[model samples]
Each structure stands twice: as structure tokens, then as C-alpha cells.
Target: MGDNNLLSIPPTFLDEVPGLADALADEPLNRVAASFPAASLPWALLAQQARTHGNYVNAYAYARTGYHRGLDALRRHGWKGQGPIPWSHEPNRGFLLSLFELGKAAELIGEADEVDRVHTFLTDSDPSVIDAILADEAAHAPGTETIVIRGIN
Candidate 1:
């Protein structure tokens, strides 16, 4: 029910969580996650952190939570289960990041079907998102002080 055409479903843009940026900058990740459990970004960050530390199961759990939260947001914004959840949109990044992290975690944990499904979902959402995310991570490798959300520095 969005900007759907014959060939494609419309892109979905999630609404921003109020005060999230300030909270992310000022508080710890755990605290932020606890405070805004419905927001995907904090959970995505938690998943990334867990994955970085080699906690695959924890990463999977966190990413799954973020992904579900993102789905709820998408539905609320009129996404009909299939549509472009573009990486170019700042608010969509959390969900895309969660999906990506979930794929990685699924791979590490030997969830072959989950990995394939995630890959397909991501490709369907935005074909360039994977490469874009990889490039962003490469540009902002570990040890950086700033937390990046796609273009957000």
C-alpha cells in the first residue's frame, strides 16, 4: 500500500525513535537497549558487539530481536511483507544492519536455511546494501570511537 508499481513494492521508511541519538551518545549500549527495547538500532549494536566478541549465540539472539522490532516498524509504516527497505534511509539502517548481523551469526552458528533466507531478504530489499555495508565497515574498522549507522557518523 506504499509506492508500489507493477515491478516493485515501495520502499519502507521507519519512524525514528525519539531521543534515541542522544541516549546512544550519552548512555551505555545496555542501558540504551533497556530504555528503548522497541527500537532496532540498540539491539543491532548489541548484536554487533556480541558478534565482535565471538559470542555467536548472543549475537543471533540480539539480531533476531532487532529484526523483529524492525519488522513491526515496517508493518506500521505500511510495508506489506515485501518491499525495498533501502540502506540509503537512515532509519532503515538499523533493520538492515540487524539482518546482516543475523546472517553472519546464522552462518557462524550453522543455521544454513536462516543464512540463505537472510541473504535473499537482504538482496530483495536492496541489492547494493551488502556491498554498501561492507564498504562502510571497511572505512570505519575497529578501534574507531564513533558508532556508525550506515552514513551516520
Candidate 2:
């Protein structure tokens, strides 16, 4: 999001570049890119949903695509995806995080219709927010907590 010409990412989230780069380096990810537009639409939708709006459908569609991609990776290269599940999960969380971080880049660019469309979709479809993402916002507490039940020293 930028001056209608240059798209830039926040410094804090620059780590995503490496994840994206990793996808490009891997053959499975390469295959997806080589397919071009035919294979890119659903993903593009995912980006719009997640990166452009806080809406759910776009986000879920985004996440579902990654889930499918992860499925693809498993099928082609035997990559379990647990290694880079975040890249696989970006689209899902993108919807909310993108919205939270970017704050209407479309509207900032005067894309009223785009803004309206995204908001409408969010309101109408009610995209499901995954728990991992919620946990993520909370500093990954869901998976990071220490459950001290019965400790008999």
C-alpha cells in the first residue's frame, strides 16, 4: 500500500518476504507460479480478502487456498508443510491482519467501491477466524502456555 504507484510492506512484517521467497525457491511453489493467471485468481482473491479487507470469505478462501497449496506440496515433493505453515496460513490471517495493519489501503487510494465491496463481503459472508490467528494476536499463547497441573516434587 502506497502512493498509488509503489507498494510497500511494513518493516515489522518484512519477514514475510523470506516466506514468499521460500515458496518461489521450492519446486512445488514454482509450479504454481509457472501456471500463471489460470492458477493465480483464487490466490489473488485470497490476497484481496486478507490484505485488502478484514472480511471473512476472502480470508477463508485465502486460507483454503493455502490449505490446498499445502496439500499440493505434500502430494508433489513430500514436504509436510509444518515447516512453513505460516506461508500456507497467510491468506487466512491476512484478512484480519491485513485489515488491522493496512487500514483501508483501497479507500486511501479512493477505491470506494472496492472498500464497499470488501466491507459488504465481510458483513455478508462472515469469514471465520481461525484460532491460531487469534492466538497469534495474543502472542501465540494458545500453543505457548505452560499447563502446570499436578506437580509432585
- Name the top lDDT candidate: 1
Write model 2 residue lDDT over 54-151, tens digit each, in one string.
56444444444543543443334333322221322443333333332222445654556767654443332123333443455478334534765777
lDDT of 1 at 78: 97
lDDT score of residue 56 within candidate 2? 47
The local lDDT score (0 to 100) that residue 12 gets in candidate 2 is 16
Candidate 1 at 113: error in angstroms? 1.0
lDDT of all predictions: 0.89, 0.38
lDDT of 2: 0.38
Model 1, range 1-153, lDDT digits (tens) per residue? 122341555678887789999999999999999999989999999998999999999999999999999999898999888878889989999999999999999999999999989988888888899999899888779665665658756
CA deviation > 4 Å runs, candidate 2: 1-31, 40-105, 127-153
- Clash pairs detected, candidate 2: 50-94, 50-95, 56-127
Q: Largest TM-score belongs to which candidate?
A: 1
